[model samples]
Target: MTDIVLLGAGGHARSVLAALALSGDRVRGYLAPVASDRLLGIEHLGGDDVLDAFDPEDVAIVVALGSTSSTALRRTLHIDAVSRGFTIATVVHPRAFVDPSVVLPPGVQVLAGSIVNAGARIGEGALINSGAIVEHDSVVGAHAHIAPGAVLAGDVTIGEGAHIGLGSRIVQGVTVGSGGVVGAGAVVITDVPAQTTVVGVPARPIEDKRMRNDA
Candidate 1:
């Protein structure tokens, strides 16, 4: 079993720990100076700076930070760890249903109750949250997040760093662009542009409308 150094110590980090435990990967400890000193009785291993202490070959790293809209921080951490000769580990919860034909990239995390169907390709550092569904032939881009209970029908494509909000539904063939955010419970039938936020029954852009008082 490979030893791991987990980054982050938030709720997502806890989830990652559970998933890692369920998958039987040994965790050395977690980093993140701002977080609590211990999680589930596991002692803190200092901050990101501590990565320098461990030989990269001896400890594989995994980031447990969940993306919201921007993947900048998560991406930066992953890349930095790799550049320093640390291996980025992949963790899939035993409860996740990933098809035999599906391919998941390094640093990917598939939490409990997630379903990734055949022919689906999950990109690097992507997080498929609990109870999320990625139907046949769907593509999840790097660092993108399918929030809890979100559903993506067959052939759907989610771009990099995009966030499909909790319980949102995406119809087949729809593409959510990079950095796009679909709000909770939105039903998306049309393509969502990059860096935009959409919400509502059929999903429309939440334009920043400035209301002005009469002059």
Candidate 2:
């Protein structure tokens, strides 16, 4: 059994908890400085700095926060977990269909109703949100977030820290580069450059800005 300390206490955290339960991993509790004590009956353990309290060698850590239009936050937490010497564990819901040929790295999450087809490689810390569909031969990079109901066709390549918004559709063989964002209900038929934010029906570049300072 792997003992884990989860980070965050929001809705995303709840989803992570569900995934963890499905995976049957041993969860110690959650850590959130600003969150309340009651999180789905699991005690809210304290600040992130309290990671020092546990023996890093014996326990693993998982960031339960979300990736917004910004992927920077997700990357930060993932790096932090690695730095603390905690083995990251990927969480996948029982209801999700991950093909035997799919490769999922540490900290990856495939939520309920999500389907990852054969030959799909989902990288470290990536998230395949509920109802998403990743077709054959697709590669989803590290810390990427494929939002709810998004569809990635065959041979699609989603780069590191990318965010594919809700209900977005990416055509076959398309590449969405690292740190890119495809907004809700968009259709992506072309290559999206790294660190770009695209929106609308056919998904065009909207703006590019540092996530930390923009919000």
Candidate 3:
């Protein structure tokens, strides 16, 4: 088992820890700026400023911070961790099936039983929840979330920061614009405009903008 360090101790961090535990990896500790509380029986080691206090060569890190609208903050954390000489481990559940030809960038997490088919390109920080199926030649943009049990067929394009709700079914070759939201159990058969929110079978616009202003 690989000994790992988590960068945050919030709810999302806990979920990542649970996933790691499920995968039988060892979590050495966590580093956070505040909230010194223990997480999942693990101790809070210290803050980001205490990076120099630990031996960087011994710890591989996973930046387990949850989704935030601020791209700058996420980039800063990734850059700083890389500069600190820590190997940033990509956390994928053991049960997730990723094809050999699929390209998954750093910080991507595929939960249990998720199937990423051939030629799919999943960008950095994307989350593929349990049982989601990303079909062949699909392109999932950076920071996109395919919720549990969602089915995205072949050649689909999911734009940056978009969220495809649980059990949603997206047909082949459809494009979901940047920051779009497809509601739970939706059947998306057509292209979604950027920053829009769509729901129901044969998804129609609920919110005009594809990106949520406060997301």
Candidate 4:
């Protein structure tokens, strides 16, 4: 069994720990700036320094931080792990159903009760949250998050770092650009532009011209 080190300890860590346990993977410990003495029955290894104690070749890491709106912290951790010459593990909950034809890259997280159908190409660092449904021929980009209970119809294209909010649904063939966000419970029927946040039945961009100008 491979020894895995989790990089965070929170509610999401609980779920990831459960998934690792179910898949028969061994978790050596977890870390954070400030964490409980124990999480999910695993030891609370000290912050950043703990990673240096173990050689990358001997142990793998899992960036188990839960990011619903942004990928900043997760992306930072990826770079940190790489700089330390550590390998990040791709984890999939045993309870999730991933079709044989799906292509999953390293660092992908497929949570419990999620279903990723055929012809889907999931990129590195993507997070497919619990109860999400990724239909056939869909493309989920690196660091993208398919929030819990979200549904992507066939042939959908989700760009890198995009966030599909909880319970949202995107119709077939729609392209949600990088950094785009679909509000919770929104029904997206059209293509969403990059860096935009949309909401409502037929999702519309929350476009504030002034806000756009500020950037």
Candidate 5:
């Protein structure tokens, strides 16, 4: 069993801990900015600085951060850990069904009840959330998040750092461009542009009022 150090203490971290429990991996502790009541039983190992005490080769790190609007923080944490010589753990819930042909890169998280079909390629640091489905030949890019219950049909390509929101569905052969955001419950039929946000049925890009206001 691997001695794992989970990073983060948010709600998503709790889920990761549960999955780790089911997998029977020994969790040394968790690191976070502050202690969280949600993770009461787990030992809080202070912040990121505490990582310096452990030899990278002795324990693997699991990035338990989850993103909805952006994956920037999660990506940064993963990269920083790797830079420090810590190996990223590829976590797959025992209840999830991942085909033999699928390749899960380091730092990838396949949560409970998810299904990754044959020939699927999951990139580094990607999150395949609970009950999500990645059909045959699908390609999920680095740091992408396939939210809970979302479905990507066969041959779909999700670009780097993209966010496919909760319960969304992407049809076959469609590509969600890098850094694109597909809103919750959206049905994407056409290709999404890079750094864009699309919503509603037959997903369409909407002017980001927040971005405009910030300008």
Candidate 6:
């Protein structure tokens, strides 16, 4: 069993810990700015600086950070850890169903109740949160997040760093571009442009009120 260090200590970290427990992996400890009361009984290894004490080759890291709006911080943490020679741990909850043909790269997290179907390719550091459904042939990009209950129909392509909000549904063959944000419960039927935020049924781009005011 590999020694694992979690990078964050919040709700997401707790969830990851639960999954790790089922896998019977050795959890060395967790790192955070301060100790979390919720993580009682688990060793709190101080902040990011504590990573220096452990040789990267002997320890792997799981980014246990959750994101609602952006994946920048999570991506940065993954990159930094790899640069320091630490390997990222791929986590799949025991309750999650990942098809045999699905290719999960390093640092991917498939939480409880998630279903990744046949031919799906999950990129590095991507998150498939609880109850999310990634259908056949879907491509989830690096550091992207498929929030809880989000459903990506067959052949849906999620770009790098995109966030598919909770309960959102992407129609078959739809492509969500890089850095895009799909608001909760939105039903996407068209291609979402890169760096755009879309909301509402039949998801459309959010009009920036600040841009309108400036104009």
Number of backbone-clashing residue pairs for each candidate, in the order shown: 0, 0, 6, 0, 0, 0
In model 2, which runs have C-alpha deviations exceeding 4 angstroms?
A: 209-215
lDDT of prediction 1: 0.88
For model 6, residues 3-122, the per-residue Cα lDDT tens digits are 999999999999999999998998998999999986788899999987878898789999999898688899999999998999999999999999999878999999999999999999
Candidate 3 lDDT tens digits, 54-90:
6667777887775422333544676688787767778
Per-candidate TM-scores read 0.93, 0.93, 0.78, 0.93, 0.96, 0.95
How far does residue 38 in candidate 1 sit from its true spot (Å)? 6.8
Please give the lDDT score for candidate 3.
0.81
Q: Model 5: clashing residue pairs?
A: none
TM-score of 2: 0.93
Model 1: weakest 10-residue lDDT segment is 206-215
- Give the range of the ten consecutive residues with the poorest summed lDDT in model 5: 206-215
lDDT of 4: 0.89
Extract clashing residue pairs from model 1.
none
Tens digits of per-residue lDDT, candidate 2, 1-215, equal 76878888888888888888877888898888876544767877788888878887777888887766877777797898788787877788999999997878888889989999999999899999999999999999999999999999999999999999999999999999998999999999999998888898788988566654667
Cα lDDT computed for each candidate against the true fold? 0.88, 0.87, 0.81, 0.89, 0.94, 0.93
Query: Relative to the unseen true structure, what is the Cα RMSD of model 4?
Result: 2.2
Off by over 4 Å in 5: 209-215
Which structure is stronger by lDDT: 2 or 5?
5
> Residue 64 deviation, candidate 5, in Å?
0.4
